[model samples]
Target: MPEEVIFESESDRSREEIAAYLRTVADNLESGEGITLKSDGDSLSLDPPTHSTFEVKAEREGPEGGPKELSVEFELEWPEDGETESESGELEIE
Candidate 1:
């Protein structure tokens, strides 16, 4: 499926800064409120269903004989209609 870019931001930040950003998102999710992302002139708001799909990924991208770039990504996805069904499972993050 084709995707449209919304508010996008990429920058080098300290671990504490990154954690603070994630905490903001977590707090919003706990409150069952929509998320509003704003960066400079770009802004977007998304209301995810309660049972959206949550995904975590780790990746390494590089050439065969070059330095490798490592990344970890967290994603939440759901249909546009705001209906979702998900199974519960144990997740441990540390």
Candidate 2:
């Protein structure tokens, strides 16, 4: 299947700043409200179903003997029609 990005942002930010963004997302999810993303001239609002598949990944990219890049990503996925089913799994983050 092909994938399209509705909204995206990349930048350097302080830990505190990153926490703020994450908190906003968490709040919206908890409230069962639409999440809105806005940039200079781009904006989108999306509603996530009550339950969805959540994925977390930690990865490293770079050639051997070269500087390595590291990243952690969090994702939530659901159908466009706002329906979702979850697989069995347990996760914990520190």
Candidate 3:
């Protein structure tokens, strides 16, 4: 089964702004040196310097219902010589 990765941050900005920011981040991650993305449909696999692979799923939820939330889900596989680690960053609306 695939794992769910969720990124939750409270932002007073509009959804469009948040989505744009995320797109930028994703694009940067995809094009950054030593990082690559192999994707199909709703899934993405990432390979980084540690020789690990990560499967990612990202989406947004908001005003159409209640408070806004940016959700990202993924499962990581570490390299034979490395251990898997999880990290996150928040963007504040100003």
Candidate 4:
């Protein structure tokens, strides 16, 4: 499926700063509030359903003889109808 680009912002940040941002998002999710992401003059508000698809991915990309770049991504996906099936699993982060 084709995707539309929304408000986007990315830059290098300290680990402490990144943790702070993630904490804010976690708080909002726990409170069942829409998340508003703003960067410069662009902004987007997303109201995820109570049950949504949560995904976590980790990847490494690099040339055969070069250094590798590692990245971890977290995402939440839900349909416009706000219907989703809940899944149970064990995830340990550390």
Evaluate all candidate structures by whole-model CA lDDT and list the values in order: 0.88, 0.92, 0.55, 0.90
Estimate, for each residue in 43-91, the C-alpha lDDT of model 3 and write its tens digit: 3434454334556667897898688889876544565465556545453
Question: Which is the leading candidate under lDDT?
Answer: 2
For model 4, the superposed segments whose C-alpha errors exceed 4 Å read: none
TM-score of each: 0.91, 0.93, 0.30, 0.91
- TM-score between candidate 3 and the true structure: 0.30
lDDT of 3: 0.55
The residue ranges of model 2 lying beyond 4 angstroms of the native Cα positions read: none
Q: Give candidate 4's error at residue 21 in angstroms.
A: 0.7
**Cα displacement (Å) at residue 56, model 4:** 0.8
RMSD of candidate 3 to the true fold?
Answer: 13.7
Per-residue lDDT of model 2, residues 1-94, tens digit only? 9999879988899999999999999999999998999988899998888898899999999999999999999999998886777687999999
Clashing pairs in 4: none
Model 1: ten consecutive residues of lowest lDDT: 83-92
TM-score of 4: 0.91
Clashing pairs in 3: 5-72, 5-73, 5-74
